[model samples]
Target: MQLKSSEETASKAELIWAITGILVVFFAAMLSMNIVITALPVIVSELGGTQIQYAWVLTGLLLANASSTLVWGKLADMYSKKVLFQAANIIFFTSSLAAGLAPNMEFLIGARVVQGIGMGGLISLAMAIMGSIVSPRERGKYAGYIGAVLAASTAAGPLIGGVTVDTLGWRWCFWVGIPLCLAALVVVHTKLKVPRYGTPGKIDVFGVILLVTGCSALLIWLSFAGTPEFFEWISLPSALLIGGALAVIAVFVIVERRIANPIVRLGMLRDRTTILAAISSAAIAPALFSCLLFLAQYFQIGRGFTPTEAGLMLLPVVGGNMLGALITGRLITRYGKWKIYIVTGAIVMSTAMFGLGFVLGADTPIWLIIGALIVVGLGFGAQMQNLMLVVQNTVPVTRVGQASSLIAFCRILGGAAGTAILGSVMAVAVGTSAVAPTNGTNPVYAEATGTLFLIAACITSVAVFTNIAIKEVPLRTTV
Candidate 1:
């Protein structure tokens, strides 16, 4: 008995460390997603790329990441997760190094496509791995750790990206995280262990192709839609391409429902909690992401702040997010009430969105901007991972991969759609503005960007009620 107890403690300790270490790298990997945004305009200007091309740089990564998420999740269910996780980090590290050495924006964008593949694996697999280790009752503690890492990464991304851009040049931003990735690899290799589980299903190759092709088309259209006159949504070629993509997507959904082992597992969508979480997550994407894009631009373009200064201005959002994560974790642990946080977060987020929309203008007060961002941060921190937890806790351990991936997919889709639609609106709004001696006033861009925020606020207001309608289930006691 004594010997058995000793081994059990040792195993648990190793598992905890492994989970913690892998998550750190996961955080670092995700940091790159947004880190490049603050520096992208400068990178594009230096590389002489057009704005539409610049947006593609972002879209390529988003679509690849979004589509691959389901693939990784399905693989985790079929193979050794530790092996897959390590493989992903290796890919991420190699891609970052390649990105750092890229000759131009085109090369950098290609490197990011590789980077996105690895990133998609990290987020989805990490959640699935956690489902294997911790019981639902105790998962919140570890989830808190994950939450902290996420908030920290998001908060620190722009700051780190800005500093790297200013001092070592933007390439170093890619190079800097390589060592951290290696560190995570070592920790997982040595410390992580789980009982082997036999694969039960075959890969759905057809379903994978269909999902990828459909999402890829949407992202391609979004990337080019507003940057050039020829890329307009109603334009003949654009309409044909987008129409074709939708038809493909509709076919893919049909395929998913028929597959014995579907890549996405549409059966989960029947769950009230899962469906609501996924939809709300998708809807909230436009508001949060578009804000991030425009605010970063506002700080840099409108306010004339350096990348570093813009990063600093974002601290309130980051700080508030951390607080919200902590409180929400405890609330779930103690009360088992998940929807309240979602409702509250949406309401708070909507209020902040409205504040930022109409209140912001040239020469607006920085303090007020920071205050509004704090609300946005609180809503995000409180709401983001909790939704994942809600879905994760509700499903069986075997289904964690699909469920987690689905929620993540919603968030990714939301972000891509938000950036695309809101970006077009902003561009048009900017075009209608007065020409200036310094920076020509783009009135239409400002108006459209502002309108997007109002739309985001409205969405969140609706989310508040949708959240309220969700019924809470008891947290799972075991995986």
Candidate 2:
């Protein structure tokens, strides 16, 4: 009995330390992503970059992150996740240092792309590692903690960026997460002890090339379409770009089906729940990323608030996300049901997005805007991690890394695509090369933002149907 008890105690300690390490890595990755939100405007301006370049700063990272996620996910199934995670940490901090030293928008964007490659590993591996260590039934308890870290890091990031921009410099936004990244690396190396499954398979090099090329083509088209200096939406360039991208992606799909060890197993996606979750994730991601990226611009440029004040204004989002995630995670754990929260959250998100569309303006009341932001946060928090939890529960233990990372890849892809499309829309609407005028308040920019939210609302509504259509599966009790 004493021996059994001691084994249990040791196991518990291991679990605690492992979870701690995962959370630290997760927090650092999320912090790196968010810390650039508030400082981006200043960074773009100081670097003499146009609004299109501003959007690329975000899109570049997201594109790389999206493109690399499946590769990392597949690799995690074959390699030691611990070593890969540490390698990713090194890449992220090194690129972050490079980003801080960037003298031009092009260099910063390039560095951000490298950072995203590391981020892709960190994001996918974190969940993959968690799914290995924790059972689905128990995951809600820990997933809530992960969600809280996400919320905390997200909340802290803009504020940190704001303060850093105000005092030290905008470059510090890229630099601030390095210490946390190093700390996470140390913790993960010591505590993460998951076993590797599966033999090393041949990577689908051609498929990766095709996938990246297709996505890059699509995103480039989106970013420049309808701009004065670029091709019009209905032009030959648009048609060729769109048509060529589609052709390449279609080829990628074909290759994935034939490949023995596909980067993204299209067969896995044939499951009803997995496919629906992917759709829901893809649909909702734009709203989440849009709010994070564009709201800062609206607050700073359209409403003429300082970075600090803008960051403070976003606190409602943080509060709502924290509460929504915590409550939903606990409830799902207790009830062993998840579909209800996802459907409800999707509905709430769509509703809030529409509300923002109606309420946002140059002189819109701060209280109304705050209310909308809160609702948006709540909806996103409830759905984000739960979607992955459901998919992980459905898949076999060996495929957890693939399943979790597939969902993440979809989310980032959607965010990247949405940011580009929306950025273009804003540029056209404002009738300027930049999203905002250099000098004063632009009512047109405010109106453009309102339109953007309306589009986001429309996109998010797709998730409501997808989530509602998702068949509920009971949470698994074993890892």
Candidate 3:
């Protein structure tokens, strides 16, 4: 891939430094979400938490993160990206302080919600800023670097969390990200700059209220569905509420179409590139997130690995992600059509999911599990960065913030829904079967989790087909 005029014109040192600074923040923010995976058992035990409550520990943050991404993205468009980025860091840092000092699960969960807001902003806005500074043709290289950071943070999150919980207690999972974020905040404040589109339009207030309420309700229902035994597949009340939520979403879309300053531009969905990227995000999110939740459980509960040991055992997944991101970035630049990689990635990821489903059990071989994980990670890294690039490239420069936000929004929502649905599946699967243990450390849980992954593989295979549906336009000779 050839460098853009802007990139070629940049002093190599300056470009490297900027990329490094952004990635540092990216790593910290990304790591904070999953770092607590291995620490869950200890945290729950100490806090006197129930299994349902423990699930919320994750769902709460994911919900908050998903809900606020579009809001933050809009703000970034209306205000200075640099200032908003710094403020988000401060918010995350302050929340970390609260989390570190939390004596109970409620306090920790509350702080995580706050922390997630900042995270939601940081991830999307950073990409918005990056798109502004780098030409579309040259953005792949920088995105590749960001993708590597993402993989490292995700892969290492549990590892770091395990070490922290064992050595310094679970609080450091939140606290550790605080100081690292400071450096990212400072770097953005000092070095990055793009002109602000000052207060461009009023926020679509009605749309915001409806969409958040609608999505939150849907997510809440999914999260609690099986645990409380709320409703069966044929239950009348459940069907009505879920159907009503769908209705509200339909009305919300209509209202969004009428609003000038919508939360997400309805028109953007018409763009094939943006649509495909968003669809792809929605498909893969559940597969990735649910795996994290179940895999940790499998290792610690089923395989008799300690939290720290489980974290260490998953290094192959992280390492593969780092390599995949680098390779995808270069290939996108060199080849230009992004769909082939996305399709290949989805296929590879689906294969990994199937493998995980089959081989997962109390007595599963470590080598096979690790190999499957590596394949999954490679597929994840290969596809993640390019989705945002596809959307950003498809839209005009003025809509970059909106496009970035939509991409982030889709992925986070996918993640939240994934966690809820798959988590529910695991709960119900284990509950109904004779396999699940009364003590949570049951071989039944492993089989149920693997079954959930099989479902994920089917879903990802659908995404692979959607990837082929995308039409890649030739890059503009000049923007």
Among these predictions, the greatest TM-score belongs to 2
TM-score to true structure, per model = 0.92, 0.96, 0.92
Q: Candidate 3 residues 1-479, lDDT tens each?
A: 23244444456666666667778887888888879887776677677765555666777777777777888888877888878788888887888788878888788889888988888888888898777667776788778989888878877899998889879888777788877888887776666646554475687778877887788778767766755456664567667668877988998999988877888888888887788889888888866666786677677666667778878876777777788888989887777767777788888988898888877777787788888989988888788888788778787666688889898888888887777777667667656412222234667766676787887787777678777887877544222
* lDDT (Cα, tens digit) per residue for candidate 2, span 265-374: 99988899999999899898987676678888888888787787777877788778877888999999898989999999999989999999987888888889888889
- Of 1 and 2, which scores higher on TM-score? 2
Candidate 2 has its poorest 10 consecutive residues by lDDT at 1-10
For model 2, the stretches where C-alpha displacement exceeds 4 angstroms are 1-10, 435-439
Expressed as tens digits, the lDDT of each residue in 44-108 for candidate 1 is 66676654555556666766778888988888877888888888888888998998888887898
Clashing pairs in 1: 429-444, 429-445, 430-444, 430-445, 433-443
Compute the lDDT of residue 392 as modeled in candidate 1.
89
Candidate 1 Cα outliers beyond 4 Å, as residue runs: 1-11, 196-200, 226-228, 432-449
- Evaluated with lDDT, which candidate comes out highest? 2
